[model samples]
Target: MALTPGVLHVTQPVDGGVGAYVAMAAADQARRGWRVAVACPGTGPLAAELDRLGVHRLDWTARRAPGLSDAVQAARLRRIVGEFGPDVVHLHSSKAGLAGRAALRGRVPTLFQPHGWSWLAARGVAAAAALAWERLAARWADRVICVGAGEAALARRHGVPGDLVVVRNGVDLRRFRPAGPRERAEARARHGIAEDTPLAVCVGRVTRQKGQDLLLAAWERVAARDGRARLAVVGDGPLLRALRSRAVPGVHFAGAVADVRSWYAAADVVVLPSRWEGLPLTALEAMATGRPVVACAVSGLTELVTGGVGALVPPGDGAGLAEALLVRLGQPALAAAEGVAAAALADGFGVDGALDGLAGHTLGVVAGVGTGAGEACSSSRLRKTPDERGFDEHCQTPWGQ
Candidate 1:
């Protein structure tokens, strides 16, 4: 009468970055012969991918933001946990982080990944409440897996105590590899962009966080300098209507496309004008496609983008963003050279290594080895001294202590 070794991933947002992370982790775990179940909203791209991967799917109705109904969601999650009987429960983002911990209360091995701290995205009263909850509920999660060093630092600065670990985001190299001549031509043709035009593509939701408006402000300057320069903002969100209303002539809103690789292939430069991020997958996708990027110098991005590979400017600085974009578009030869360097660096952060690191951490927790500090809790190839592990130095105290 022993419980089977299984992992259950629970979350609310079933699209975008959190969705991608859940699908990748579940599929990787399933491939390794572990019984994996995902408890999330029963629709969207994430659910479809999980079904394709043959993972057990449990429908959970939860809102993106917290409310009184969280009690209902927590109850539902607890019931799913009972049925699945997993040894480990991985909570993704804030909604699931709250519900999963409340439901499980450390009854099972719990791994909570905030993706980005909730308070960072909130303000005033909501922000204070979020920080308070994170600090108080920190103990409910046995381990906290931060997606970037910036996120980890923010947690410490706000005193969200826990055993923190960093796992930088990565993407699938095979699917997002560099485009050949035929691909470049075909993708441009499909998107109806002239081959000679200098194209800069920004791929992400049209939200304040993604900074589409900031990019638009910069795009005005970029188009003024080079009339043939075109900017495409791909992906839709709550701000889509508002963003489109503010768009200038050279800016095109591509909406949401199934295969983002096609857009990446057609681009001369990829830009992420995010106000904040936990290492955007869009930048990695563009780099993998052998394109240089111009992005804000935010937490997740600072870890990945460097001067040789791409240009990083201060967040919300429209002038700075425009300057960086001009730097890439004005000198095609330099941009192409930087693209080569970007691809080389991006290859080092392939999905395989990330999958392995996740498996090691989850397996360690189930085996009761998670009580030790950081990598000492896991026997995966991810093990290295604190500095060598590439985590923010500020994260040392919580994980080490």
Candidate 2:
């Protein structure tokens, strides 16, 4: 009998976007009759999701950041790869991209998705080292898949070379349909938000990268104009306590909730002030719930939040962020119109296309085709990053153009 095709996804930080991405991919691959396995710390919501999906799990004692223990972890991952016999190894985020590549060393067809480049998150010596490693590690990947065009462009800008392909992040649409008034009222009541108040919900970790502080600063201006407008910062992180303490009137920290859809249902508008992203799921999820978004005009948001579907302000620009939020929150009619457009845009980003694209890419790599860098989806559109903002590009645009 022919050996079954298998793929192994490896990552650290088993609670955030990276973890969620891996879980979704592994489950989809498994459901399609591929032998899929995931190797991570395996001790959080993602682990539980993987268990539910029936994807083989390997315990990897990997740290969020690089440490001396990387060698040991790499060895463990190598053993798992050997045991699982994956034809393709898909590494998610920096931690897995590093250790998985180190373990495999081009012995297998490996695909690396940075999620967001690590150099963007570090500084000084650490940043320099990350850039250097990324440049060197390009040789290890059969293909480098980016979740957003900005991620691919940023990699090139930093001299991190690879066969880059963009596969925009997607969400499950069935679970996130537009909320009716009854659903909205229940969600708002659960969160202590008044049904009639203009509410902006931000769903993400309370971290510097997520720009919660920027949102808080912007919220001051928003509240100054509309006293009834409320801001809910959902998700937990290291900065949670500090952010909660500094929050003034009209700001509520919901911490982490199991079902974030309820929060989306409660919102008049959704916002993300991220400094960078590989197409944040918060914006996608909110759009799926038929809500307009006000997000920093960086990375992935540039592509997804175009036209009147939502508004995008410059990164780190609190005043601009505030203005965008005010436009969405202060004008209910405008927000409602944008919400309709948002739902239309989100209709193009259901999980099926993304899952199919990833599967195609993996199969092509395993078949010895270089990079598997073709268009992931015919419907996927491309948008320029801030530096090249006015440029019109299509999804068919070749890399390095």
Candidate 3:
């Protein structure tokens, strides 16, 4: 008899890194002859990409949290899980994770990937309620997997314990590897930048969590140091108009390009100035593209950007970030060296590592490694009625508790 391949993953738009992580995992699984199905909101680049790779994608969009839309999505997912007959449920994002676990409870083993916890993102009275709700919902999951060690630490801090898998996200080096000088030159020229101009790329959603405003502020400082230094940001969000309006000199918002790989190939440096994150794909792709990263030292950024790959500054320290950017700007040779080191560091985060880690953890969960059939992860933050104040409290610290 042959081993059966059946895996079900739940997520949202699948546009950003969180989405990219699942997409890559499914592709790797497919290569290994696993039957993987991803249930997300609707059709977009993510859905299309999954289709291209022959992974099943269901039409389901679980909203931010506790909305009528979310309720419906959860019901739909419960139905989908029954229909798919999956061996494991890997849920991504807040709403998807909570709802998937709730739906599959007492029947299927669940593994949740908190791409970024909603408990850490929500704030105020509503936030308190949300945090409490997160704790209540956590009881449904068999295991909570954190993509970055920082997030795994946070899971322990929050009380989601036992069998908590720390799986660092991965990148496809083949798709994002460094282009030849000729290839790089053509990409930069197509973007209309001189061959010798200083260029740094910021790739991610334009949101508060991603710290786009901070990048804008940092760009203001970078322009003061070198006017020739051009910053191009890829990806769009609610703040697109506001970010564009507040744009400083030498800043260009590319507005969510289709081929993000090209953006990496066209830059001398890449920056992920997110206020909060969990093994950001932007940094991974940049490193895979062999570009120096000037980023905030939060989440896994410092862990991955070590050894001359680039400079890591304190999360909210604007001056330190500016200084780091200037260091790369003034010394092209240094930036190139950093890029090489970054590529080497990023090589460690390829698809194989992430999938193997995820597979091992999921297998363990299926084998009943930790947490009882109906229990919760370690955390005082776990709640039933939406700990709005607690959620608010966590959200105040940009790093996300």
Candidate 4:
């Protein structure tokens, strides 16, 4: 009889996209009857959701940034790994990726997923250091799972070597679906938004990377052009207070909400002016909810927001950002048409497919199989039956090899 495979997911940011991804993956693994455990801080939505799902959780208190405590953090992680005895270790985001690899040191099958390359978020000496760390740490990872093709490309461009695979991020289609007129009206009423007001929703952590400041700068122009337009900046972060202090007219800071779907439903268009990303969950969720997106032309955003479905302005181009939002807000028919196309595109990125692809890779790694260097495998190519414990003979060669 085959023993149930065990997976341990270690993560640091336990609130935004990374946290949500961990929660979804852990829950899915548990439902499949695998022994799944998550090592994360005992706070935020990740911990709360894991507890609700009845998955075992170990308190792994770690900060978002590396510091003197990282050595201690790695030691604690090593101890947790010893106790859990997982068949595979999956580290999420940069902080966990850093500590997990250092702790395990390739002693076990390990997967490192940098939701976004840490170097992209750093500057000067910090950026160089981050890139160097990633290049060095690649040897510790059996497989580096990238959330999108752009992420994998970035790694190769920066000479970060590893067996890389792109598993495009997916959204919960059931939870975020197209909002009809009645549904839209109800969502607006629920959020206290006027039915007639032009609304553009931005959902993400209010940090430099997420670019709430860029959005606010663009909103100034958007408001100047159209006084009736309203923008809601959702989610909370360290920059929330600083951003709110600017006091841009017709802008509402919703803070952090338990549910972001209603905000998507209440929007004429969804906007993301992020400086960088690796297939942001906000863009996927908004598209799945049938809303047009006006985002900067960054890595992940460029792939998701095509010409027909939405507009992509160059990163930090405030005038272009404002123009894109204004075009969508002023032309409801065009926005609605683009939204229908957006929903159609989002159908191809269901959460089930993404999770299944991840499971296939996990099982493959446990069985001592690795995908070819820099290969991007989709769920369709990597799908396995529920009863399957590991890769079959056909899956041994890696997709497209």
Candidate 5:
């Protein structure tokens, strides 16, 4: 008799992209008849979604940043692991990656997903320490699942040695489809915006990583050029109040909303001036809604946003960012054409495919452990699903293979 496969997903962030990813993965695995449990904060979107799905949730008390309480958190995680007895453990984001890996120490088949590298969010001495920790922690992770090729490239470039696999972020195409004219008009009306308004929507947590501040700075140039242009900064975070205080005219701070689809539909263009990303879900959602994107030429954004779909200016270039937005907002015909192209490109990246690929990798890792082969599974053996076949250069074989 074989035991049922079990997976435990641990994450610190209970909202935003990381939280959403965990919820989706847990729900998918549970529906497949696998024993799946998510250990995360009891509040936020992740918790709410898990509750709605009737998936098991274990309350995990952890902070968003490294602190003295990490050891305590790790101990709690160890207890959870011992009690649940999962076949595999998946840690999402930096804080969970840190504590979970530290607790398990390769004792279990652990998958660490950085979401976005921690070092990218740090500065000066903190950045160096974060990078060093990642390199040392690589030994504990059976596989470092990067959400994008650029994220995997960053790991290799920074010498974070381990089995690196890329499973690009995906969107639910059913929920996010191209908005027709009537839908657009209705969305605009619901948002209390005029149908003819040249709106550029930015949807993400209001943080330095998301670069909402940079987008606001660029919006000055945009507003100066076209006073009729409107910019809506959706979502909320620690910097929300500060950003709102400094917001210029025509810039609306929506804080946070239950649904972002209406915002995408209402916009002529979507903007993401993120400082770093491991393939942001907001960008994918926007593209799936048939909205052109104007984003920073950063790792994940560069991989998705092409000239035909939208514009990618050099990161931190305010003038360039402003110019990109101007081009789209000024020409409705061009933006519409690019949006069509964006939706076409986004068609290739569906949530089902991404989840299926991840499922394949998880099963492969478990099989390797069962065979006492550790992480030394062959590429052919791992590529069981059709989605896994499209991983391209993003997935690599184990070292010494």
Candidate 6:
């Protein structure tokens, strides 16, 4: 059989990294003459985002615990697969992975991308139950596609032993480049921030894994020194209400900005203090946009934030986190130098690179394609921190166990 248009069914809401990946894949696949469509819990800004892209939508974000949601979604998607006749079903996030994989049931090839699993993110709130749920989801998978090795390892830890492909979260460098002077000034003006204020920005949902709570705490610590250090947060999540109340004296929450370029342009220092991650898109975006990043040195983050391109701090260390931010904010020349280093670093993760890697991986998963080789070696083998040691590259992680 010849490979053609590939369809991916996502059960999670259309938002965040998974959404971006689907869009890129859809556009690239369309250009390559593949019929691509995404059926998701198209509600809220994410649904609106999908509409802008002219994607196929589905009304099915019904609450699905590992047991109930999985059964309902799987049954519904089984019908969808039969009707749509897709080459493969690509599942995004944990919920979608279990549902989509189980629904397809080998009738068609299924690709599961655990874009941060529920177990890793859901702490103290029945986490063991989530893991149990994932073990069940893995049963229906053809090829498990992990966003990063950390995620892949987590999958393995939970008994998902099989052929796994790790297609990392990537960024489009062309759109997110270093700011030219005119554009930089205009962006600063739009934000009503002075170029001299030393802006710090964090882009992602205000959720637990994103560690906005930690960022808020760190913000207070940083502001205790340079009150001029302004914090500009981008993105919204379930934690928006509590995030709004954070009110770090020098921090400004921009809510969810459609065009985040202005914020990226205005920022001299960028931070992603996530408690856990698969492979964060924000760190790549910040590096791609030519900003100095200060991210936690763990998981997939250790893979990126290498060299002298960015700074890294251990996760959950509030004082260490504050010190890392302050060090960069205090030195304009050094921050600019790091930004330039980041610009050099950004060239590695082009959209073309991602597509070349992703398209093959994706199509193969759908069409039963294979490299006929074992899984790729993980960067975790390299024991080093993110700094002058050549670990401070593009910092992040999104999906987890």
Name the runs in model 2 displaced over 4 angstroms. 1-3, 371-401
RMSD of 5: 4.6
TM-score of each: 0.92, 0.93, 0.87, 0.94, 0.92, 0.88
Compare the candidates by lDDT and give the number of the best one.
Answer: 4
Which regions of candidate 4 are displaced past 4 Å? 1-3, 373-375, 379-401
lDDT of 3 by residue, 1-401 (tens): 12444778888757888777778888776677767899887756788888888888888866654676766777899999988888788888887876786677647888877887776676688767766666776777777777665676665567653455456677787788976588789898888888888888888989888888888887888898788889998889879999899898788899978888777888888887877787787888888888899888776675567768898889988888888888887898998888888888777777776677677666666676663312222221212212222223223322212
Compared with the true structure, all predictions reach lDDT values of 0.82, 0.82, 0.75, 0.88, 0.86, 0.72
> In candidate 5, which residue pairs clash?
none
- How many clashing pairs in candidate 4? 0
Question: Model 3, clash count?
Answer: 22
Model 4, 1-401: lDDT tens digits are 22478999999999989999999999999999999999999988888999999999999999998899999999999999999999999999999999999999999899999999999989999999999999999999999888876677778778898888878888999898998898899999998989889999999999999999999988999999899999999999999999999957899999999999899999999999999999899998999889999999888887788768899999999999999999999999999999999998888789998998898888888988867533344532322322111222212444423
* Candidate 5 C-alpha lDDT tens digits along 1-401: 11457999999998899988998899998988899999998988888999999999998989997889999999999999999998999999999999999999999989888999999999999999999999999999887777876777778778888888777778999999999799999999998999889999999999999999999999999999899999999998999999999999999998788889999999999999999998899998999999999999888787788769999899999999999999999999999999999998888778897888688778867776321223222221221332233333344444213
* lDDT of candidate 2 at residue 359, scale 0 to 100: 80
Candidate 5 C-alpha error for residue 401, in Å: 22
- Model 6, residue 120: C-alpha shift (Å): 0.6
RMSD of 1: 3.4
Judge candidate 4 against the unseen true structure and give its global Cα lDDT, from 0 to 1.
Answer: 0.88
C-alpha positional error of residue 193 in candidate 4 after TM-score superposition, expressed in Å? 1.6
Model 1: per-residue Cα lDDT over 100-155, one tens digit each: 98888889889999987888788899989989999988989988887766677677
Candidate 4, which ten residues in sequence have the lowest lDDT sum? 386-395
Model 3 regions more than 4 Å off: 369-401
lDDT of 6 by residue, 1-401 (tens): 34685576575646666667766666677677776777776565656766777666666664534555567777877776776777877777777776776566666777777777778767675887777777776657777766666666566656756666666666787789987567778889998988678888999878888898998888888888887888888888888788788677777888877778888888878898988787887888888888888888767676678778777788888888888888888887898888888877767666675666667776667656654433332122233332212212222332221
**Cα lDDT for residue 354, model 5?**
83
**How would you encode candidate 2's per-residue C-alpha lDDT over 133-237 as one tens digit per residue?**
999999999888888767776777777776777677888999889886788899889878776788998999888889999999888988888898889889998
